[model samples]
Target: MASATEGAGLSVDEESPVSQKREERLRKFRELHFKRNEARKLNHQEVVEEDKRMKLPANWEAKKARLEWELQVDEKKKDCVARGEDYDRVKLLEISAEDAERWERKKKRRNPDPGFSGYAEAQLRQYQRLTRQIQPDMENYARQREECGEDFHPTSNSLIHGTHVPTKEGIDRMVEDVEKQIAKRSKYSRRRAYNDDADIDYINERNAKFNKKAERFYGKYTAEIKQNLERGTAV
Candidate 1:
């Protein structure tokens, strides 16, 4: 039977055409995988080099100090958690004066190529102002509830509500905030021709001047109309 099959065209050691095709496919797949891996490594190395060029600290010593300080903060937080205390209360280790100065200098340094514009800066300031205005009150309320939860004893049927009644000052501030926002939006609509890099200060000053002039002209026109009506002038 084996001799007959061999004569017909099938042989075990001669390797079947299907097996040869499978071997070729596998070899091509391995070569493709190796090339992809090499490309990925090269890309990663390029990213590392770019990050190195954008130095956060001038020297290795400053970088080392920053890392050590961060690690110390992490350890402190862990220890606080282990002791069943509030991790937020765990203060991070402060950097040395030299390191602090280095960090501040780095912080103030502007990139040669700026990625953001004045509008972006204004938006960021608005965002920070809003956050600062709202977050502390919210956090205080949350902290109060959390502290209440830490009690082991439950007072049944005690109707206790967290009261965060807005004060008069807060209400006045809210109204002022709304007015300011309306003014800002109105100003933006009126000054639609200004470019992205246009100076906000200059635009504001010009707008203010125009607004004052418009107000004076309107006031005088209204006064003349009232005088004409009282004097029985020709209609």
Candidate 2:
């Protein structure tokens, strides 16, 4: 029994020639598999890097084209202004003045129409109604501010009157009030079916008032507006 056990235990040493040969073959197979996998990973990374390099030139060309287009437009504008054909303000202003006088004479030849008077009356009524609605709110706001106490100032050193130190609640209330006012005005306009004609009339009236005030305060810069408009083609 002991001889049989010893024979079983002495079968084959793993470090022997035959066993070592088999182990070396397995290790070679594993190394080949590992090298193939490493090659595939490197190939994939190279493809990604090549794609990134390809996009760079395309982006740079697009940016260069946009800049060139802007330059061309600017050059064309400069050439047009230099020609003094359409953009000659001195000639244009003289022509405009003559056209204005002709328009005035044509307007005088026209008689008063009943439809015009009716439309004017309707617009006046709408304006008066809106003014009345806004006036009370304005007056109430002023009264409340006055009643809030003069000592209630926004800054540490009070240099301005009618200023209130707004808390978080006060700011929230103000935002709500402004939103409500906007909603009310939107509803009012919708209900009244206010059209472009009403908007144009309002703009014209407001512009007239603004022009009067501007002339009073900034008449010295009257030529500046024209010069700036000529140079920049913007208001």
Candidate 3:
């Protein structure tokens, strides 16, 4: 009976460790499941917040309808115009003489109105621009003169003819000066990148040029019509 009790006690203690390990694994699995659920909830909330932020522009449908209606009116007007029909439905604004005089005065004020230049104007302007570009480097000039020895004085021709001794420092300085000049030129000579995918409806270069001029003259007045046409919402 005593031996049997000892064996049973040992077996119970051995089974206790196995049960504890299984419980530990179950606790870890439950923790991971809870963490995953919380993560999913957080992601769902973030998505909902993002969707709230991204909303359509206010009254877009009504604005689109109005644009379509205006486009229809413009198309009808153009058709009447092409057919040589009297489309006198639109009323023209009548400006007073005082308003016209005021507008002329405003234009004159806006004009810089530099007085007329004579035959030598181009040459004079070129010289003026060159003079304006002349930035004197007092520090570099003084340092160079000091290093060339006390007795060395610059003759006008010496610096102009590029007769300087070639050294590593001199080459580096020249490179720096060239880079600075390039930087200055780049600021003034920048061109915008051309997008190849833009709507180019013209058949040729001449037609394209005419289209550009036409757009420049009338684009602001017909922006809504253009948008409606592009959206295929034109009546």
| Number of the top-ranking candidate, with lDDT as the measure | 3
Off by over 4 Å in 3: 56-235
RMSD of each: 25.7, 32.8, 30.3
Q: Give all TM-scores, in the order shown.
A: 0.24, 0.22, 0.27
**Candidate 2 per-residue C-alpha lDDT over 1-235 given as tens digits, one digit per residue, 9 for 90 to 100:** 9998777666655347788889999999999999999999999999998898887875877888999998976776687688755534544555777798998999999854334358778688656655655424565566667766564344676555535454586578668867976887687653334356532413565686687687788878776875786789653
Query: Which lDDT tens digits does candidate 3 get at residues 36-141?
Result: 9999999999999777657656786798899999898788789879988655543123456788799899988894535557758756875676666667678877
What is candidate 2's local distance difference test score? 0.70
Order of candidates by TM-score, top first? Answer: 3, 1, 2
Task: For model 1, give the RMSD to the true fold.
Answer: 25.7
Candidate 1 lDDT, 48-162, residue by residue in tens? 9889877755687788888999998799888888898877644424456788788889987955434457897868877876776762567656766786664423477554455
lDDT of 3: 0.78
Worst 10 residues of 2 by lDDT: 193-202
